[model samples]
Target: MTRKPTSSDHIVDEKFEPWERNGRMPLPVVWVAVALAIWGTGTLLTTSGGAPETAVEAAVQQDRPVDAPDSGAALFAANCATCHQPNGSGVRLAVPPLRGSEFPAQGPELVANVLLRGIDGPIRVDGHDYDGHMPSFSAAFGDAEIAELASYVAATFGDRDDGVDTATVADLRARAVGQGTWSGGEALAAAYPGLPPQPAFSSASVTPVSADVSALIFEGRDDVWACASCHGDLGQGVENTPRLSGLSADYIAKQLRDFQTGTRANEHMSFVAKGLTEADIAGLGAYYAGLSVPSTAAPILGGDLKRGETLALVGDWDLGVPACFSCHGPSGFGVAPNFPALSAQQAPYTASQLAAWAGGHRANSPLSLMDQISKGLSTDDRRAVADYLASLPAVPAGSTGAVAKEGDGHDL
Candidate 1:
């Protein structure tokens, strides 16, 4: 008596409504279908276990800081690859190629400007038109991060061996504080068409006390020995001593300051610098910088000329050494107030300095760059490089040295 089998129980009323009377999908079911579609599209950021992740949660999962881009490559991959492409080939007619572009070769400033200020509207690169918008990176990156990004770009695609430094980028940042995105390539080119500004001290501090300075160099003061006692009357230096002529004022001032503060330790130099006032230091710097370096210094050592030449021109990277010219400047003329003229320096003096650096005795160089490099050099290698450096003539023969005057200290 199980409610006797009835045919009516198996059939539903055709006229009666189930849940809704309307012949449409239910709203709840529609919402669920939309959610499933969204999941299928793969827009969800997820963990390895396939759990959904929010922005902060994703950072936590990856163990990366919320704001940090991780690395230069990561920064470029995230921010630049869309239009620039992963390799920096860029989109034809829409974007520009970074590789072989004359812009990167021009200098760091142009490249830095574009990155910080973005480019809007049209710009031509390598004779091709790039008409897309490049978003500003100023807000998203710090100077150091930007420098790294620029360096990565330069190294990877632009064929620039010397990478951009943070100080340069920071300088750029200071200049670009209030500037907006670039209007056009032509305008930008017009504005900064010349050389980027040089950072060293370009002017002398006090009036050129040429005769007084010359007297100071030739005659000993109460506290100091006569410079000429060790150096030549012209400050050209005796055997094994360093010549003070043709060096940058900034370089000379910094050296004297370093000696005075014990940042650069030399018994003689420490005493000499300690006896001089800041004005005296600046006056001496101007006097020396005004004089031209002699074309040649008498050799105080001998080495394999061929090996020394190779080291000066192109360094042996296997030995963890860079060429002398790379940092010293092209043709060893000098790179302003930092690396002085290696050419025409006394071989013995150069060798002694290198030895000092190797033995951890001197440590005043920026970033200790020289100290690290010297430590890696062999004794023979040092001697060879020093000899080659002393062989070069700073200028043509028949040129005379500086002539002390009343006030004006012009190049002689």
Candidate 2:
């Protein structure tokens, strides 16, 4: 039935043709092709609205439509209770009280700005200065979330209004972007007129005898509060507070004597200075004047260190904020009598002061610009700006061309 002798019948081809080649397709290769085809089909199906359902969409479709609750108390408890405390009393000399604060009761715009931008530096509230920083909520929240927060604060802590809407939040955000960062209350007083005057501190009336006698005052006491308490341990203040660490002894003694005689009327300092004897004042002044100016600590506020540096020096036009060096000096080693040294101050302390000014807690300066400036900040901006300030190196003594000398009162 089979012809085996025929050469043509024998399956032998000396010249192989590409079309006649026979080989097994690799399992891996076949699998890869099938996978690619399936992927392409899935993509097409998805685009065509015939794709398989995702867990999220299916759940959303099946779930009941629930409205967000209108409970400010609940929202505050959930979000702000941790730092502000449940009763809003706040920490002593640390985080400021939110209850009954003018900031909360002022306007929705301010509240929204505070919530969005946060706060920094020496903020004055009800005549009391709070030197701490508030963190930002912009990154964590959207327009709707910001609206909810503003609405909650307005209804609960602040005077009740129609409530903050999404539009208001958006408007505030736009304005903030135009305004940039805010300066402390003291700076505002200096920049603007028709603002309230700064509160007066009581000055001491003690006369200096000699440096030898001044050193004796601290002999028995291991560590009592020094001239650095209100003036900053390093004599570098964020704002409002004056730097005294690198001043001449004469300047230091003069301030102490002024405080004793009621010439100055700082409530806190007047009380402290009144307790010191004339000899004690001379010794304290000498000690501070003799010490070297310390370096600034690292910034605690959240932001890019490099970016902060740029903003501090050059400022951001998009936000309508000014360069810090314009007023704070290039090295941040503040000038005497009013300007404070910002080089080595704490970041939180700086932030707190800014919030106080914006909220109208502290006011005793001649400038209205600070109020305007503070109104423009968001919480995030405040933190970033403050962090930059904190990152700056300390200005060495005599860096500002002031020589260090005992009884000169120019060491701080």
Candidate 3:
């Protein structure tokens, strides 16, 4: 104890922790420890990832803008609100309701093109018409203005998420420049080809043997096709066949009598109506006018109601299109005599008429604006617009023209 401590003695006396004592960890142990830590960290990260933030949350965190541009509201107010209205309910007969219309939501390009070009002559809007001049904005407004207006209409009135931009307007403007003015019939034909041919009315198949008033006139006689042959089996009418449902009995009776008396002339209808007796005409008129009109609502594909309203009232003048309400009447009930009511028509039936006009199947009248419009429409455009029309409810009778009730005089 008295002698000086040696180096060995000092080393034995020093306290050493477990880690300090070992120069390095065992290879396997080290690897296992690192792997465990990594796994734990990865699990934590995955759990956090599973609870992703919502778009609003992300925007809040990133400080992104959410409000629409000021110009969007301004453009809409100035150009679109007149027909669409501030509340977007749309006018009853003169214009279609924009809040639920189908054309604005079709796509930015389609909406833009319609705005630039305009439409004309008895176009249906929300089952109504705004048959006035729809002036062209293409020459007056720049791409930005059109884009802003379209964007506002699509988002606010159409209830769509897709936004319009300048690019879309520019593209439509270019297309309008290349194509001259378009009539409704021309537009429709250009859009949809391969439309089915009009079937000849078969009186033989339609004639009824029973003398029941409703059966004889509405049901037709054997060897004489019933009115329903070319019209819908339900009187809704098919492709190229006009809808007979919901028309006034007086109007219908008058038309039938006219056909028989040679007062009215339609190649197909003349032959059919000419053979009908007064009793037959009366029965048919009563049967059709008495029947309730079925609902024609279907899921619209690629349309926006807001845009439809605009096209209906304002029209795209640049494209030589005319306003729908001019001939169709303020409400889509039509002006009577020649114009057909457009509201509440079946989707299939509507599509067929557009296709017929485009294909030159139904245009026989010298004043047929439909033929001109059908030729101008692209297939896509026809579908978009017709779908919009099909979605609308029929206008009440008294808005623009006199309406005949079920028992009204025999003039549908």
Candidate 4:
């Protein structure tokens, strides 16, 4: 059988031989390519108009609920509730109460104006004066959202049944283009003269105190003397004592703690601080932080008023002193969580503290910045700047003070 090889054996099927002998693609590969082509073509045809949604788009769609867009209460709780409070009875002296306020009740237009543009300066609400800034909502909220917020505020606080309309909000927003914040009450009054007459200033109208403040400060707790005895009923301190109203809660608490630890030396305050518990310090801080009073501080020291103004507004670069406003905020309203407001602070207290810093008697200033700053100032210079600060408004009209910079030493 092996005697001779036949030619028939050598001559194989032409197509099969070529494919098998040569390194060509396998049948499975060809089939896979064809299947993939078919699937890609089908997918293209099915979604010819657009590509599939991105992960971010899908996530956004899933995250937002339908009702969230229209819910005024939800928006308020997210945005306005922090300062104005949940019940709309805003913090006294710090924020104006909306519950019984006539401003919102007048019309949606007035509220829209405020919401869109914001308002600033010393405003007399009820009988109390509030020197603070209301920020603009134009950038934060859309027309529809603004309308919803206005409606809610009107209905809930202003007692208005009809809420504001989106169209009206849009129109007002359009008109507010290129305009700044409303200056003050006078400016708002000029715009719409039909506002309710402000009641006469009443000393009796005091900020509502918490139970803790009442037990400890208003009424003496155990051996501790009543805080109101030295600091006035409204936390507006008498002669030689520092004004406590509108000071940052953290600053107040820190000072008390410092006093207790003998880090800050004051005969009366040291004794008082020793008796205070941690809870007492916190309560006292919060209570005073909520209280705001009009500044009646005047320059008793015979410092040059113009020179004082110059020093406060822009510091003496020749002497290497920084502007008071640079750290304390433009109008000395104080930066939150740290800096204490100096605009309405008593002149004596400010001067004494400055002197203390210069003499190394007080060592609790942030980074010892006050220590270095005070060292540059002479006794008369200290008095001059202190007087100027006392004379300035806590939150000046149209000034950029409330918008604080991140992580800076604030003025006390």
Note the Cα lDDT for every prediction shown.
0.65, 0.55, 0.56, 0.72
* Model 2: per-residue Cα lDDT over 167-199, one tens digit each: 777787777674533444443344333234433
lDDT of 4 by residue, 1-412 (tens): 5668888878778567554676878899999999999999778656644444543455554423213554878877756664576798875455678888777777666877898998665566766666656767798788877877887777778887776677788889989999877766667777778775432333332456678668778787777888988888777775468888777777789999988998888888898889998988988887787664555567777777667766776799888888786676545667665666777677888889889888988888767888888999999998898887666544332122344456846334
Q: What's the true lDDT of residue 290 in model 4?
A: 65
Q: Give the TM-scores of the predictions, in the order they appear.
A: 0.46, 0.37, 0.43, 0.52
Scored by lDDT, the top model is 4
Residue 41, model 1, lDDT: 52
Which candidate comes out best when scored by TM-score? 4
For candidate 2, give the lDDT of residue 263: 58
Candidate 3 residue-wise lDDT, 6-37, digit = tens: 88765743576656755887899999999999
Q: Give the per-residue Cα lDDT of candidate 3 at 70.
A: 74
**For model 1, how big is the CA root-mean-square deviation?**
24.6
Task: Candidate 3: list runs displaced more than 4 Å.
Answer: 1-53, 56-213, 228-234, 237-242, 248-274, 278-294, 297-307, 397-400, 403-412
What value does the lDDT take at residue 396 in candidate 4?
31
